[model samples]
Structure formats: structure tokens, C-alpha cells
Target: MADNEQDHEHTPLLQDQDNNDNEQHNHHDQTSHRNVVENIRNLIENEIPNGHHLNSSSTPKRVHALLPRLFTLINSLVDCSNVEDEVVTDEVVEYLCSLGQEVVYGLLRCIESMVAEGQRDVGRKRLLDRRAEITQVAAAAVTKAFVDKDRMGTYCHVLSRPYYAVGEERNTAENAIEIAIRVHATDFIADIEVQRCVQALWTGLILQVEEDESRIRFVEYGGLRRSRRGLLDWFDIGRLNVPKYQNNMKIALFIFFLAMYTFVVNNQSPNPNIIEWLMYVFVCGYIFEEFRLIFEGGTAFFLGSIWHWVNIISYSMFMVSFSFRFTASYILTDKSKIVQYNDIAYDLQALLAVFLWVKTLSLLDGNQYFGTMVMVLQKMLKDGIMFFWLLAWVFIGFLQSFFALQKAETKDFNAAFSLLVRGFLQDPDWELAEVLDNKYGFWVFALYLFLTSIILLNLLIALFNSSYTNITDSSEKEYLALFTFKVFSYLKSPDQFPYAAPFNLIEVFFVIPFTPILSKENYKSLNRVVMGILFWIPVLTIAYGEQKRYEELTGTNDDDDIQGGRRRYRHLTLDDISVEDLFMIEDVDENAAAVSGETAIQIANGEEGAVVDASFTGWKSNGPVNETFADFQRRRVKENEARAKAAAAAARAEEASSSSDEDERADAAAAAAAVASSTSAGPAMSEALVQTLLASIARMEERQKEMETLLKQLNVPTAED
Candidate 1:
């Protein structure tokens, strides 16, 4: 009865506990819902001002301010585990999409920053977990904005919004790289609608500008419309003021000329053709463009770029080649002379063509793979210059020696230098000895050959190897520096011409004229007159010419034809063909088995070591057997000791021989002194002194023999013994 009473009391307690837990869970859910709504409301209020649209210039600052709050909310939603949380998150994203380009850009940048930071912080689990969702939502929002606008120009303009444009953080390379990474990670290139959009924006970044005016113009006229900003602005040509854009425009014009040159080369006619007339026009345009670049940038700026020099030399050659070709076809009446002149011109054109193509590599200096190769080659060349100087000094020494010794035969320094070069090439002529009558000539030649061939040449090889290795080691850093320089140049460039020349030239002539007229307050009628006169002719001509050409080339009647066929070519090799024509599996196995059997037989006969097993399944030892560290150390020590003993014995023998030479010289001096002193005494006294000296010399010889015997017993060989 007491146990039953206790059970009834515990059951009531359990029921009360369950009720309290349910109430707390309900309260938490309500609080979360309230927080989500409150945060969303606050974000919208902060980002959008009264009486302004989301795309208004004033909204970018407000949107920037709202980024931190949005990131906080994204973090909170990341750990959310129910359908309600997903619904709230989707609503937040919908609000984000409505706030326009700046907001969407900020949201992407925030996610990128979170991801970049998460890699370094262990406590950023929410960021890591929701990264994919965040990226997907942000990408979808950006895509929607792009579609809604229908203009890649507007989209590209939106992407140029700066995060921090007025502080030390402004123009930061890391910030740009992060933005690029975010754009690349979206895989927007796969989206057919935005492929051109992505490419134009990426090109702007590569040019190191906020936006490329040429690219913007290309997009605008190429058929994209801006909804808020209106379709056309004559004054927008002011963007062409940027130097990088001007440079790019120049490159495009050069490429066009190069294409014309290619067409002329392929024409195959001996006589002048219509293509040659077009080439004259292109050459004139190239000359004008080159001079404009030179005069605009000034002498220092023009000379500073290696590409400029390349351009100058190539154009000069092109001019000469064209002149020669013209003379050969028109003025030169003799057939043989004409052929010779034509050959010369062709050779010059070929050389110029090589240099022109090589200059194009500078355009890809921002690409990692190509840039790395260029940088490595540059470093190798820089270091090789120093090595060249050292080699030159040694070469000069040999050159002068040979020139002086074989002056009669060589006739001049050039002839002697030629001979020295032959020696360097390891083709020294022994027959030159007969021409060099002086005995000293042979010894000098030997010394020159020894120094140049054995020491200097090997040193040059070592220097080259070291330079190549060093360049390879730092290739990554060099590429990064090049990429960063490209970004920084764009960021620091002024808002100016975002297109290259010739193309930019059109804007200069046609567009700049209308800027002043459009800016005036009361010139509506005049503006219309100017627009009709300036714009319609070019626009209509381009449209009609393009349409006519398209119809002619494609043989299609449809005005809105979009389908274009790509030319395809297939390459076939042995591996691409049917296996039956080559070898069957049975035949391959038999050949492999036979080779293995032969190898096994050689190994068994001890003709060769077993480098491979008979089955050809695994490696076998052909090198020396491995030794333990301790055994290796012991062997090394014994070898060192033997070497040291040999060295010591040689040193002692050399010292003993030197001492014997000193003793012999001292004895001869003593005998001469004694004879001089005895000369004054008498003939008999001198004779007695000589006999004593002879006896002493015999005694010294006997002592020398005893010393030799002792040295032999010690196994230390003396000079004579």
C-alpha cells in the first residue's frame, strides 16, 4: 500500500515536468520567429531610404551599411533545423533580391569573406555548413537581377561598386582577388545568357579598371538596354579618358591590321589585288595610331615598354617589305631582279610577322600559366647577363693571347677571335701549330685551351643550371606579382577611355561633338538635329552592310537567323584506330613474356643484375645493397683514418727532403769557408783541410743511408728511397 502511494506521487511529478518542457519549447519558437521578422524589417528599413528606388546612387551606401546585419542573420539561420526557419530564410532572400545590385553584391562578398575566414577559424561551423546554400541563393539573386535588367552593361556597372573606396583599405589586391574568386566560383560562364557579361567584366578586371568603356560600348550597341539609365548618353564617351582603355583600343586596332596582313599573305596572286589596296588603308591607320601613342605618352613612356620597341621595329620592317614588293611588281622590269627583290621582301615580312606575334604575348601577361613562363624566362635572362660578363672576360683573355701569338698567320684580331671561338666549340685546329713558328705559341695555346674548355665552360654551365633552378623555385611568386600589378593598375587608373584606339577614335570624332550640345538646358531641337546627322549614317550603314554580308555568306533568307555551324576536324593516330590492326592481347602477352624470359636468363647467367622480376610485377635491386646508419658511419670513419695516415706520411717525407737539401747547402758553404781560411796558412795546411772535409762528407753520406733505412722500416718513403 505504501509503494503504490509513492508511485502515484511520482507520476504527477513526471506530468508536471512534461508540461513545463513543452511551454519552454513553445516560447523559444515564438522568440526565434519574432527575431527573424524584426531583423528582416530592420534590414529593409536601413537599406532603402524614403522616396528612392533600390538602384538609386544614394542606396549603395545604405546597402553597404546593411551588410553586417545581413551576415549576422545568415549566421543565425545557418543552424536553424526546421521548415519554419527555411521559410524565414527564403523570405529574407526575397527581400535581398528586391534591394537591387549593390545589396546582392554585398551579400556575395559577405559570404566570400565568411568562407575565406572559416578556413582559418575553428568556431565557424555555421559558415562552413551553410556555405553552399548561401552561394546558391546569392548566385540565383544575381542571375535574376541580370535577367530582369536585360543589359549586361548595367550588370557590369553594378559589379564595379567599391566596398571601401576612400580609405587605406581602398584598392586592396586581396579584396579584388576575393571578389574575382566569388564571381568565378558561381560558374556564371556556363549560363548562356551571361557568358558575354562575365567575359566583359573579367576583361575589365584584367585591364585594372572599374569598367572597360569599349566593352561597355560593345555590350550597349551589341543589343542590351538599360532600364533606369536610359538607352543612350552622348556624354558617356567621357569614359574613354582612362589610359588602360586607350591602350587596349590600340591593341585591338593593331590586331585588326595584323589580320589584314594575314589576308594579304594568303592572297597568292603575283599582281596587286584588292586586298593589297585594303592593306594600304590599314598601314595608314597603323601609322596614325602609332604616332598618337608616341606623342600622347611622351618619349619616356613610349620607350619604357618592350612592346613599344617591338611595334616600332616590326612596323619599320613591314614598311620596307611593302616598298620592296611594290618596286618588284611595278618598277623592276627584269624578271630575275624582280624575283630576287620579292624573295627579300618575303623574308623581311616573315621576320616581322614573328616579332608581331611575339608582342601579342604581353596581352596574356595577366594569365598565370603564360605569365609564369614569361617571368621565368625573364629571370633566367637577367641572371644569364651576369654570367655572360664573367665568360666574356675569360674569352677576351684567350682571344688576346691567340691574337698576339699567331699574329702573322691570323692577319687580324677578327681572324684570331674566330680561331678562339673554334677552340671554345671544342674544334681546336692542331695544324695551327705549324703556322705559329714561335715555341712559346704552343705553350700559350695549351694554357688557353685548358682555361677556356676545362674551367670556364664548366662554370658557365653551372651558372645556367643554378639560374634556371632559382627561377623555377620562385615562379609562383612572380606570377602573383604580375597578377597583382594588373589589378592595381586598373584600380588606380582614372575614369577614361575603356577601349583601345581606332575603335576609340570613332567615339572621339562622332560622340565628343554631341557632349556639349546634350549638356545644355534649352537645345532640344538642336540636339535632335545633331543626333540625326551624326548617328544615323554610321548606324544604318553598319546594319545594312552586316545584314547583306550575313545573307551572302550564310545563304540564308531568314532575317533573325541565329544558328551558326562550327567547322570540325578529326585527328586519328595509332591509339585511336582499331586494336585489331595493331596488336591482339594474346600477341602482346607473348611479346611481354618473351622479353621477360630473356631478361631472366641474363640475370641467371649473371650478365646483368635483376632490375625487374620475371613477371614484370615489381622492382628488384640493381643498385648497391642498403647498409644500416651505424655500419655506414663506421666504414666512413675507417676510410677517413686511412686517408689521414697517408696524408701525414707524405707531409713528413716532404719535410725530411727539405731538411736534407738545407743540410747539403750548409755543408758546401762550410767547406768553401774552410778552404778560404786555409789559403792564407800554406799549401800543406790547405791539403790537410781538404782531406778532413772529404772524411766529413763520407760520414754525412753514411748517416743519410742510416736515416733512409729507418724511414723504410717505419714505412714512410723518403724522396730517393
Candidate 2:
């Protein structure tokens, strides 16, 4: 009935086309739709043959008349949108089956006529017979497309919402899920609300039926999304972010032993038996670990516990032992261990171990106390009582070897006194020549003590005293100064190489204090100190040598002159220059103006109150030289306020831009869709054809309703109570 209505409305257009064709050709085209229809009617009246090949022009109009009827049938099969009742939805699905193969094949033929050869296979009727299966696939594709669209919508929502714009928390997950449920329900699920509730019930039922263990381990529909690779796999060797170079205990211990040997050689002390023993022990430990790895393959527990701890123990032992002996010897001998090339070498080893311990402690975070304790020990070894012991050893070694030796040999007190008197009274050739000789340095031991007490003693005292001061303050500046001194000292004599070898376990005992502080939260502040110390040591060592060379060249003998020489050379000093002079000398104002001229000018004029741009203009400002307390405070306050305002403005602008983008996106999304009807006009209908198509659709729906009513009546029982 709907097709008949559409055919009646479109017949005039076919008649007009036939007339036009006839006028152009100057002949009546019987192949035209009007001509063909008339001819077919005439043939029926006159009893003519039935096998007539209709031309393309006439067939299309005839097909057009049949298309609306066929479109209604196909549309019903997969039309689940806005369905509120299951009975009606079922009736629609059942009514679609009544079309049978004949109508389906005809529809396929029409589609084939319009579509290209590549699409003809897809237009086949074999799959259309199982129209339900085809509908399911189409629904899945449509659902996936809608889900992607919904995700985009949610992203826009979160980006555009006023709360999000103002820095309130964004609702990303909630928005995504809400959109997914809404678009799918209205477009795909028949009796949408009821079907969705049923799906939820089915899911809950399945979950309840599952065993506890299975449920726990099963792929949950709802859970935090994780990468396919398990957590442990990421930590495996050769994976992402693993430590590239391991701190080898064997190499560190060798370096430690080398340092000890150098220390003994430089100080001209007792047997280096301790250093030899350390080397032997470290080699043994390495051999043992190598054998274990060879036989058992490496395990995590072994690596983390036994291997790492053993190295720490060895390093701590070396440091503690060295500290005890060196401190005692320096005190007794009255020699400056700080000046010795070998002592520097040994400390370098300890320093490396300390640095390694610091790094490991960082990995453990704040939870590990053992690592922190080790760091404290390292500090004590580096800057604590070692200098006192070194002083004691320097003084005591001379007394024990010389005065005590003479006292023991001299049975007469007068002879002992005379022996001491003879030492100074002796000729320069007799005393100096003997002291310079290989074996008679027993007398010269007194000279070593005297010179050390006066010269080397002060240096040792200053070195340790300054280190202690820095350790107490633990400031970046102090650490830098200490490191600078160490570097200068080392460069003055390269034989005292820092960390020349790998580290040992015992030295790590002194590195534990750093573990608690080397966390990511604390590292930024602490790292500056550590890096300053590390870099400053080398630089200061060079500076110290240069200063010493300058003093030597200038022939300076005053202790104050020596101290002044040690300081870094600069063109200007605070007391010697004014704010304006400093500005002139360094061209500070010019540089600041070049970087940000407007901001610099405002700051200089004090008109804009030092307002800075968002990109760190305030932070980069050059304030008054040697600024007074009030001036510094005022400048700082103004700069901070300007920076804060700039940052706030930038944040507001970013939010505004984001909201505008979202508004544009939402507009585009709204424009993309047209007003949808209870039933679509199918893929074959267009706006130019809407009025004729709607008349067809309305009649088809009425016919479907009548059929459903008739079918229900037929199915009803005839027997009554």
C-alpha cells in the first residue's frame, strides 16, 4: 500500500521524462517507463508475448516504485532504537522474516544495480537470508563506532567543564562510562532500559556462580587496567630502568688497598701488611662469588642480600681500620696525613664507597636506617677524629723512636742530655748530611716532629676543622667548599688519585647517614650539595696549586698571605665596590635588559613594581649589589608577587583556550547529526525524496501492526471457560 502511494506520486515525473526523451529523439521511445507501462498494459489487453527486455530507463522507475516497500522490510530487521516494548520489538523482527527469499533477492538486485562490481559480492542474498546474523555484525560495528565517539565526547566534556577549567578535579572515567551506556541503549538495544537491566542481572549471576579462587584470578570486567607484562618482569635484568653498571666490590677493594699502600709509602710508616691483607681478602671474596654464580646461576635474593651486604661489609672494614690506624699514627708521628699523597689515595677509595652507598640508599627510599647509619660513619671517617689521631701519631712516633730510644740507650742522664745538645751543636755537614742519608733518620725523627707540630699540624687542624664545620651545617655552600679543598689537594699531587679502584663493603659503613636523605623527595635539595662537593673538590685542588705557585713566585712568607692566596681571584669585592660600580663592571643592567627589556626597565624605574613575565623574568632579575636587609626583603616580595600573578594569568589563559576548543568540538558533534525519526528512511532514502518516503514508511508500519494483530488472534486458543 505504501509503495502504491509512492508510485502514484512519482508517475508524473516518469511521464515528463518520457515526453522529454521523445522530443529529443524525434521518435517515441517505447523503452521509456511511461511507454513500457502503456505497452505492457496494451499487451495484456491484446494477449501478446511475455518475454520483453525492458530498457534501463524504464526499469529504474519500476524498481524505484518497489524500493520503498523493500527498504521498510530491511529496516525493521535491525531497527532496535527507541524500542520501549519487547512484544513490539519481537513483532517487528518476526514481520521482517515474512519478506522471504524473493523480496530479499530483488533488493539485492537493486543494490547490485546501483553499487560497483567490487560491492556486488557484499550485496549477495545468501547472507541476507540469515538477516539476524548480519544485523548482529552491523550492530557490533555500529556500537564500536559509537563507543569511540563517546570517548571523544567525554574527553571534550572533561576538558570544557567549568570545574575542570578552574582546576577542580576532572571526571574522566564517569563521563566515558555514562556516554557508552546512553548512545548504545538508544541506538542498538531493543527495550533499551529493560535489556540493559537484564544484561546486568546476567553478569551478576555469572559472577555469583564462579568459585572464589576463579573469580579472584579471572579476567575481571571491572578492574584497574594493567600492562600485559607482569610487575616482576619489568625489574628483570636488561629491562627498562635497571642499573646499567653495578658497583663492583672487588674493584673497589683493590682501589682501597692501593690507597692504603700509597698512604704507607708517602708517610714512610710501618709495614703495609694491612693493605696486603685487604687485597687478599677482597680477591678471595671475588673468587667465592664467581664460583657461586658459576655453579648456581644468579638469584634475586643472593644479589640483593648476600652479594650487596658482603661488599658493604668489606668497604666499612677498610674505612674503619684505616681510620683507626691513620688517626693514631698522625697523633703519634706529628705528621700531616692530609698532605700525604698516599692518605689522599686511601680516602678517595672510601669516598667512592660512600658515593655508592648514597646511591643505593636512594633506591631504598626513607625506610632503610642501616644505609643512613653507614653514611654517618663515612662522614666521621672523612671529617671527624681522624685528624686528631694523625696529629697524635705524628708527635708520638717521634717521641717513641727518638727520645725514648736515646733515653733507653743512655744509662747516664747527663749522657742523654749531651746527646740531645750534640744534635743542634753538630756541624751542618754532620747533622744535615746524616739526616739526608738512608739509615740515620733516628735523630731526624725529632726534626720531623718539630716541623710537623708547627707547619703540618695547623694544616691538618684546618682541614679537619673545616670539614667538621661543613658536616654540621650540611649546606650546599659548605659542601662545595670542602669538595673544592679536596680537589685542590688531589691535583697538587696526582699520585693521590680519588677513587682509583673499585669499592669494598667496610667503607660503606661510613656512608649510611646519606641513605635516609637520598630519597626522590629529598634528592633535589641534597643533590646540589653532593654535586657541588664532587665538582668543587677537583676545581679547588687546581686552584690551590695555582695559588701555591703564585705565592712561591711572589716569595710570600706570611701565613696571612698564604691564606689569602688560597681564595679564588675575582675583579670585584663587596667592600671595594658599590651597587652602581658592580653594575658597571659586569654590565649587569645591560644583560638583564637584553633578556627582558620591558621587565628590566620596569624593575629599574620601580614604576611597574618589578612585575615579571610568566617565563621566569622575575627570577632572572638582577637586584641591588650587596643589597641591604630591607632592600633585599622588599625586592624579593615584589618579585614573588609579580611571578605569582603572571603564573596565575597563564593558567587562566590555558583554561580559557581549552574551554573554547571544547565548545567548538561540541558544536561540531551536534552539527554532525540530523534529527532522527522513530524509524529511519533506510539507506536508500534522501531529503529530496523524504515526503514520498515518509508516506511509504507510515503505510508500512500500519500494515505491520495489522499483521501482528492478526497473527496474535490466530495463535489465541479457541476453547473458552
Candidate 3:
């Protein structure tokens, strides 16, 4: 009993010793890991961004080694064993963010260096050489990086290529921009250099998308052929695509042009003159562009936002109006019919004009006030959907009762709808009360007014007010998200070389039809020739302005000493922010409302050709997913816990089964021998039985002692209750 007490006392000491060894091992591992992280971080900071290492030359060996290594390090830091062990402390995550930041800085610096050659002469015009010249230098490096890295299609999305898993798949790719976005390196993204590159990159991608989308697959032209690269050379790329002249400037100009065209060529009177004919052709192409979005995004995606519905309704109105105007002038014979069509057409065109101008707000994302408000309004509109739903049900109930209770022989659904709408708009008709002489219909109307105008309307106001407050409180973060979306929107656009609307007319008629018939070289040259011919002046203007702006920003213009762009060495306070908060939209978890970085709560899915997510290797994702980082983490934690429990249970079951089988086999053998000895007969049997009994007894004693020893080893009490 005293020995048992001593053994029990010694057990805790042994456990402490084992635990101490494990702790030491863990400490050693942690120290080693920290050293590795520090070394990688140092290497990234020291080597990747250094001007000497960033070789635009043939032998950029250091860059080649370091860039790949830098990405590898980011991948490791994001997903290594520590992540699974739940030991991914805040420090490590922060350290990981720093490494990602450094990589972004390096890319930005590399671009700045490459483009720096263009601004050497202290002016926009002169550069080291033509290839090394101002506009060309910027285009070549920035464009090539985005264009060549085909897999880097949508870098701004959270669930972009290399799906960020908790333990296994969450790692960055060769695309530097993608890693920067994943790590939420906002300051890095916000930098002038990185912004320019990203802008140009998306521009290049847009150009590619347009080239592909524009192609006609006629069997005559061997069906659905696309050019290799839409913007063939530096000169051919859209001037508006570059920041020099500003794409927004180009978009605003195009809208203004569209508005003017519509007003001037008002075919409401069925007057198809030369200008009207040209306007008709131009609008046809514009309509095509808008309508094609339906096929690409599908019905659910179209219903995702208010803007999408507006696009569908406005364009549909225009098409119908055009159809009526054309039929009235050309197809219809009767004067009365013509007059009726003209009246409807006029009304529709007038409505379309309003929508067209209002849609300019969509492009106003460049300005902080307009852009942020646009986001808020879009959110509120979506929120109001539920309010509108309840209002509809109540209105319908009132309508049925009011119509049923009406003693009048004639009842108009349209009049009923108008009355309800007016009531909601604060112009309720008490005429029903007077006419009905306080009947059931009058009472129903009063109830409708109370429910809809008083109760439902106020509820909606509170909802929008709450939504407005939530959005505006984080206005800065929201704006940043919008800006990221601005960059991302460019990439999402299907048009590879997105010419502003009126200009897209040229591509639709001229470039697309000939693409499949023409050879790759010829097709490319044709696109180049067309873009240059149409936009050389603008392109040249952009180049000059960019170099001029470049000169001004760098202080290269102020003094002979050129104040070239500098590297970001230390992190600014703003740099250290939660990536999830700043960039990623909240997970919507539903397919319809999920898309883009609209906090938007634009958060889903499968594009047919593209098999995206972790398994995909393509540039575009298969489709949008409705998960965010937080959603993924919760799901992954649950899965890991389930798997762990399942594994542990299986192991214990196997261990117990093996132990029970061995014990049962040993006891069966003992029982068989005892039975055989007891059945022995006569003198010989008696002598053998005595011997067998003695042996069996001895064996039983040994077995009992062994069982006690085994129980002690297993921490099972030897004496049981």
C-alpha cells in the first residue's frame, strides 16, 4: 500500500519531466520558425525591391530568384502547420502581412524603376530613347506584366485564384497584385506607382476581353475566332486606358456624346434623316453591348443590383421605342395607328433620356462624394426591397377588398394601382371615403393608408436610416472598398479593349466580322491600325500629359536634380489594418446578391468554361462564390474538429479491440486445458490431472500478476469496486 502511494506520487514527477521536454521542443521549434520568418522578411526587404536586383535586362538573376522565393515565403507564412495547430498568433499574421506588403512594394518599385527611364529628360516628351521613352516604357512594363500573367485576371476579389483556405490551399500565386490584395495591403495598393500599374493592367485585360467577346464565329470565317492580343502594340492600346488623360474623362465625354446624339436625333416624329440614321446605327451597337451583359452575367447576376435592373429596363425601353418609331414611319399605313405609336414612342424616349443621364452616376465612382453615396444608395435600394415586398402584399389585399366592395359597375386595376401609389406618395384619395359614404371599401382604404403610409413607410425609413448609418460610419473603409472595386470593375468587364460606347460601334461593325477570316497577324495589325487611326491624337496627348505629370510629381521639372520615385521602407500606421474589414465584402451566402466588392455584401458560382476556386488554374474564376474569409474559417474549423474527433474515436476503438482480443484468446486457452485435465480418467488420468491442475494453478497465479502489472501500466486501479 505504501509502495502504491510512492508510485502514484512519482507519476506526476514523470509527467512533469515529459511535459518539460515537450515544452522545450516547442520553444525550439518556435524560435526556429521565428528565425526563418525574420530571414525571409529581411531577404524580401533587402533584395526584392533593390534597384540593382530589379533587372529589366536579360540577366535579372537576383529578381528571378527573389521574386519566386518571395511568393513561396508568402505561401508558407499563410498556410504552414502553425495555421492548422491554431497557433497562428496575431504576431505571425502581422508578420505575414508585412511580407506581403514588401512584395507589393517591390513590384511597385520595380514598375516605378522601369517607368522611370521615361521621365529622365525632365519633361513628358523626351526620354532615354523611343523604346525607353515616356509612354512606351510605362506601357511595356505595366501592360506586359498584366497581359502575360494570364492567370492574374481578377486580383481584387477575396476568393480569387488560390482560394484562401485555413490550412491547406491558402497561399498566393506568381501574380504579385493578387497577393497584395489578399494581404489587404491597402497603402501599397493606394500608392501612385502600384495604382498606375494596376490601372493599366486592368485596362490591358479589358482590351483582351473585348477582343475575345467581339469576335464572330461564322463558319465562313471558320466560326468564333479571336485575336491573340487585342491591343497589339504600345501605340495601339486605348489612351483612355492609361491614367494620363484619365478614363473617367473619356467615359464622361462618351456619355455626353450619347446624350447629344439622342437629343439631336429624336426619331419620335419618324424623321429618319442622315444624322438620325447614324444615331440609329450607333445606338444599335450600344444596345448590343448592354444586352450581351445579360448572357454573360445571367438572370441572377442581373438582379444582383439596382444598376443592373436599370440597365435592363432602360435599354429595353429604348429598343421598344425604336421599334415603334421605325414601324410607325415605315411599316404602318393608318394615320391613327401612326399617331398612337408616335405618342407612346415619344413617352418612352423621354423616359430613356432620364435614365441615360442618371446612369452617369455609375461612372462617378472616381469622386469620393459621388462614389461613396452611390454605394450607399445602392445598398439602401437593395434593403428597401423587403419593405417594398411587405407593402405590395398589403396593397394587394386592400386592392382586392376595395375593388370587391365597390358598388360601381366599372372598375379599373390601373386606377386602383394609381390610387395606392398616390397614397404612398402622400397624396391619398379620400374620394373613396366620400363616394363610398363610409362603407367597407372606405374603411379598407383607411386601413391601407394606415398600414402602408404610417406603419410600412416608417419601417422602411428606419431600415434605410439604419443601413445608411452603418455604411456611412465606416465611410472611409467603404470608399477604399469602392476604389478597389473601381479597379476590379475594369477587370470584370468582358470587353477586352473596351472602347467607350459610341466608339464600340466601330469595333462591332469593322473589327469583329473580319477577325475570324483574317490571320492572327493580320487580325492584330488590323486592330492596331484601327485603334491608331481613331485615337492617335488622344494617345499622343495622354503620353505627353503622363510624362508632364510625371515630371511635376518627381521634382524632376523643378530643379535639374530629378526627384525620382522612392521605395516604401517602413509601414505607415494606416498600413496596419484588418484586410477583411478594409477590402472584403461581407459574405452574402446567396447566389443572387453576391458579386464584386460592393459591401455590397456583393459576395457568390460557376462560369461554364471556367472551373475556378482552389482547383482552377485559369485567369477568371469559374464564377462568384458567396463565402468570405470569415465564413471559410468557420466552416474549416468545424470540418477540422469533426475530422479530429472521428480520427481519435477510430484509434481508440482499434486499440480496445486489439487488447480485448488478446485477453480473450489467453483465457480461452486456459479454460480448454482445465477442461481437458478434469475429463481425464483412471490412475494415469488422475496422475496427469493432478500435474495439469498444478501447472494450471501456477499459470493462473502468473496471469493474475501480469494482469495487475498491465492494469497499473494503463493507470487502471488493480482492485476494483
Model 3 residue 206 CA deviation (Å) reads: 12
Cα-lDDT of candidate 2 = 0.34
Query: Model 3, range 91-182, lDDT digits (tens) per residue?
Result: 33322222221223333333334345445645532322222222122222332233223212223211221121123221112134433443
Q: Which order, best to worst by lDDT?
A: 1, 3, 2
- Each model's C-alpha lDDT? 0.48, 0.34, 0.46
lDDT of 1 by residue, 357-398 (tens): 887787777567888777665555556777678778988886
Q: Where does candidate 1 have its weakest 10-residue lDDT segment?
A: 614-623
- Model with the higher TM-score, candidate 1 or 3: 3
lDDT computed for candidate 1: 0.48
For 302-382, candidate 2 gives per-residue lDDT tens digits of 342233444556555555655555554454454555445345545544455554444354333222244334333445555
**What is residue 118's positional error in candidate 1, in angstroms?**
40
